[model samples]
Target chain A: MQSMSSSLNALWNHLSDSPLLYLTLTLIAYQIGLFLYQKSGKKPLVNPVLIAIVLLVAVLLITGTPYDRYFQGAHFLHFLLGPATVALAIPLYRQFEKVRKSALAIAISLLTGSAVSAVSSVLIAWALGGSEQSFLSLAPKSVTTPVSMGITEALGGVPSLTAVLVIITGILGASLGPTVLNIVRVKSWAARGLAIGTAAHGLGTARKLQVNEEAGAFSGLAMGLNALATAILLPIVWYWIF
Target chain B: MLFYLTIILLCQLFGEALVTFFALPVPGPVIGMALMFVGLLIKGSVPDGLSVVGESLLSHMSLLFIPAGVGIMVNAELIQREFVPISVSLVISTLLCIAVTGLLMSWLTRNKSIGGYKE
Candidate 1:
């Protein structure tokens, strides 16, 4: 019995030492999250990304594992973000005709939305006595994760903090965006999708995609456009204002 | 699938080259997306393989962000201290953002012809 217990302990230690352990754990957690999300009838409130993060955090805490260590494995998944972002052009292409028809409306609305999201976030945080770092971080909160993280780092804010802010912004936007659009009498799929994508990025795009194809396409377009606009505009705006 | 991925990586490489050459502040992937958009425009249609890969990636888009989202653990202290400001701003600003964008798009496209479509 003693020999068997010692062997099991050795096996556990060996598995824990491998980077694959964290990678496998993250994938498994996300699969569970996806299951729950589907089981819940794809409700926005049961966000798989949110659930996966919570589960991973809990696991890390329970194991007393450092985030940096876990990230070593998880970074492989993170690295895919670049290629995935480029993949967004596929949907945009599929909807190009519709996008071209609404070019003026889309461009104008995107500009206004991007500006409003950035400015309002900073102002609200500042008014509530958020530090300078918080102010800068919040400035890019509404943009997509990868772009926003780059913006935050460039602006001297904490990237990890900005990452958190971006996710929460996405969750909130995905949950409340459709209802808000209905309240504002925005009935068009293009408008609804663009609004949510502008505010929530990929998460909003995912939500929009689940509802309607046209809406999803526009949301994807808005997400990419917002990334470009925020990356270019926020830095200039920050320098000009401060 | 491999070919499609290669195209994406090439676009990203081109995007990175452009950013570095111009010293643009934009992320390479965003630039890559733009270039791919242009490529599609020139091509006039998305290839089946490209669409397949793209759709797969996008379908799992939320999962890609999990690594970063879990990064919240690193900022626990800062978040704890600034919880009110952070949460309040996130909720209010997101709502305002949605409203502003939705209203503006709906209003601008109300005439229908301006957007070149009747809907």
Candidate 2:
């Protein structure tokens, strides 16, 4: 026991000196958690992201480490989000010929979709006595992270909270999407991609790719275009409403 | 998967360095993503080795998001107070996003002029 304590003390001192060590370890730990999550089969509650979060939280608790420290290293992974978002353009570009052909219809649908999302939420929340910021966060929930975070900040909601909602929304959409699609008897690749991306955002787009290339491509288009649309529209609506 | 992860990590480091030097408002992951995307675009096709890594990473993208999601607890007070707007926005936006995307795609493909043709 005494020797273990000394070893732990040495390790702690090492991590404190080179904080990136903790970040690297945290990522490794997350990957391992993911491996275990998959190995455990398709239980909804045992979702890998959920598992990884729980594991990391426990690690933070035991090690007495601060979130800022973890974020210092983990932020690297977060950084990949931007390019990954743009990389979405690849699949989208692959489908450009088709997308270009359908430009008008796509534009109208996105416009309507954006408005409905923003307006209905505010109206409903006002009915329920929800605050303006609550309405603000919900307003950009369907868009990608960076845009949504910006909208949240602009509308006087918590950006971090928006981030959480975005993740949850993405997970729920990805996991439940296909099942629901089948139930609704929705057919066609465009329908699949549109539904996945609109409902799920980036993660949903990733999920759509798993089923087929066309679906993935369309999903990417939906996510990106919607991101562009909402980024432009959300603030305007916020100004109009406030 | 390991190689892809390493590359992702390297991008993260690069993103941080660049952001620090330039003081950009952009996040690191976003920068890393941009670098990787450029590399992939220039390459045109994902290399066989990296393809495997990307597939693995993308397959379980949810796991990568979990830690951040749980970070919600940090702002529990704000969320509790702002729950109405946030929740409403999510549901409404999701519904809108789906409806718009669907309508647009349908309209675009109405004549079957898009990429894939109807059989």
Candidate 3:
């Protein structure tokens, strides 16, 4: 009995020491989140991303695990974001014909939307007594994660802080965007998708995808275009202004 | 699956090379996406394997972001300090952006029957 208990302790320690433990935990937690999200009628309010983060944070805190350690395992999932981003071209490709017909409209709206998203956030942060670092970081808050992080780093912002802001921005956009569109009488899926993607990036795109494929395709297009535009324009505009 | 993964990775590899070579400020993945888009345009259609793989990735797209989102804990102090500004700007600007974009897009395309939406 004593030997069996010791062996059990040894097994536990061995498993805990492996990076795969955290990775498996993360995937399991996400599955639970996804299940909860579906059970809750897949409402935006019960976002799987938000739930998973909360659960993981709670677990990490309870177990006294460092964020860096958790990240060591989680980074594997993070690395896939690049290829997933590249994969977005598929939906955009499928929607090219629709995009071509309204190219001018899409361009005009995207330009205006991107400008408003960056400018309003920066202005608000400045008004609220945020520091210079905050201004730089908040400027790219609306772009998707990887692109936003890159832009924030280039613009002399805190990329880590920007990552947080970007996720919050995405969650906010996903939750509130549709209601705002409804209030404004914006009924078309294309317009709705464009607004969500431009404002919320990938999270918003994911939300739009749940609604319909057409909306998803447009959201993907908006996300890609917004990433490119923000990447090019933010730096030029920042240098010119500040 | 292996073939599709290779194609995706190859595009990303090429994109990283291009960015490094040009010293571009853009993220390699964004450039990779653009390259892939252009490739599709030239090909005139998305390949079945590529779309299958792409769709699979995209279907779970939200899952990929959780790790980065969890980084919020690391910046808990910064967030606490700038809580007001961060929260307020995120909420207000996000709303304004959505309203402006949706309204403008709807208005601009109101006269046109485009993308199956008769607006």
- What local lDDT does model 1 show for residue A14? 90
Weakest ten-residue segment in model 1 chain A by summed lDDT: A206-215
> For model 2, how does the per-residue alpha-carbon lDDT over A55-174 read when each residue is reduced to its tens digit?
776777687776666666476566545545544544554566666666676566656755665577667777878776666666677777776787789678878877877876786667
Per-model TM-score, in order, reads 0.93, 0.74, 0.93
Model with the higher DockQ, candidate 1 or 2: 1
| A15 Cα displacement, candidate 2 (Å) | 2.1
Estimate candidate 3's alpha-carbon lDDT, on a 0 to 1 scale: 0.86
Q: After superposition, how far is residue A115 of candidate 2 from its true place, in Å?
A: 2.7
Indicate whether candidate 2 or candidate 3 has the larger DockQ.
3
Off by over 4 Å in 3: A1-13, B114-119
Q: Any runs in candidate 2 off by more than 4 Å, and if so which?
A: A1-7, A16-46, B1-67, B80-100, B103-119
Over the stretch A16-75, how does candidate 3's per-residue lDDT look in tens digits? 777788889888888988899889986767877888899999988887777888888788
lDDT of 1 at A60: 94
Model 1, position A230: C-alpha lDDT score: 92
